[model samples]
Target: MSPYHHGDLRRAILTAALDVIATDGPSALSLRDLARRAGVSHAAPAHHFRDRTGLLTAIAAEGHGLLAEELAGTTDLRDAGARYVRFARQHPAHFQVMFTPNLLHTDDLELTTARALSGAALTDALAPTAPTGDDPHARYARLAVWSLAHGFATLLLGHNLDRLLGDEDPEEVLRELPMFLLPPA
Candidate 1:
């Protein structure tokens, strides 16, 4: 790889890493490959991320933060769910790494905090539709909502929904998914 100077080496390395993950899956990501993609020395990525796990941790943290921002924009649970799917579509690399905690430093403070913020945004989105006073049911409802959205996104990303969805937009499908769970008003 031709050595080059990047005004923002950290961001450049992260961007290159994400591209690699997106194109080849995280299993194929290597610091040396990222450095080459970034047109920097092999040691350049190590200086920014320390190791592969550290790089994945940064991606996970950034993914959660982006998801939090997306979810926080809307109070409607359905809208939030749609946004979740959209975020996955927009940042498949980050989405892939974010959910696979085994690839990350789970105790990393940045990852933990970003994850908590995303969880809070999801919970807040559920607040409008959540039943009153029953914490157990509320908790269950939150899990259900999260599972539905997350499952749908995962399936869509993996192209597992091709037969079922055909030409339909996945985000639109997710926005309409709640209708199947609730009876007519």
Candidate 2:
């Protein structure tokens, strides 16, 4: 196979990588396979990603940044949670890798940068609901919000709850969960 020019090879590999991850799951992602799909020589991805972990790390980083920006754009804090849910639903591949820490290369500079952006965005979104009292209260608020959103998404993605509830439009049930989060009249 021909090697791609350096300029576009990296992007092309990453794009192909995302597609592969989406359709085949992270465990099946192989740079050699990705390069084949990208139409570059097998070694081309190494020039950009160094190795399989490097490529996955980059994908994880990009996923984090995308989720961070999407969550940060919400007009309401509640909406931020909705956006998080929606992003996972829409980009299941990206969302899956973004949260799976073992797949991320902690030493990678770009990965660190992306993780920080994601952390900052989440912290900012949680700021409004932060407990008005001591550290414990603040911790609880943050944990509560995160757990609520994350648990919902995890259940929805894995079809655990859907199976339990027996397939009555999961989103509709999720939409109603937010109402419980609302302050009662």
Candidate 3:
């Protein structure tokens, strides 16, 4: 075994990648730069990740796992939806990479498994409102819920709604979303 593999090299590389992305966005990611920040040899990150795609796939997978944990905490779809938005805001770098399939190794087992776990958590939260059997409304309901949260998060991330939001906290605004968007309980 390579002596460079000694302590948590993979985790350190991944953490450095996330810090770089959080500061400079995904396009700024470079294994050499990350390795330097991680205090590892330039080849060390490559040894663990193979390439940028491999590293990004791991990041995206980890993002999905975190998202699953966030969504799983809420019993109600509305709260789950709010947590979805919060997760995006809290982990913008991960959020950006997780949804961009072209940037990830889409066929990787870890990525797909993590993605599925996140999807299942969201689906399960919405299951109570989802119509059973051959109805397409259930699928549409899921789409609508996801769309609402994603669109809101995207807009917030881009600061596109700052004029509309003015002085109010974004999280507070998001918490009010269910009052207007969700069906009466």
Prediction 1 TM-score vs. true? 0.92
Cα lDDT listed for each candidate:
0.87, 0.75, 0.85
Candidate 3 clash pair list: none
TM-score of each: 0.92, 0.84, 0.91
Error of 1 at 25 (Å): 0.8
- Where is model 3 more than 4 Å wrong at Cα? 1-6, 178-181
Better of 1 and 3 by lDDT: 1
- The residue-by-residue lDDT of candidate 2 on 1-185, one tens digit each, is 67855458878888887888778888998888888887788887888898888888888888888888887755545666667777778777788788787887887888888888877776677666565545887767666766777788777787777666685655445545644442321
Rank the models by TM-score, top first.
1, 3, 2
lDDT score, candidate 1: 0.87
Report the lDDT tens digits of candidate 3 across residue range 67-128: 99999857666677778889998999899899999998999999999999999898887877
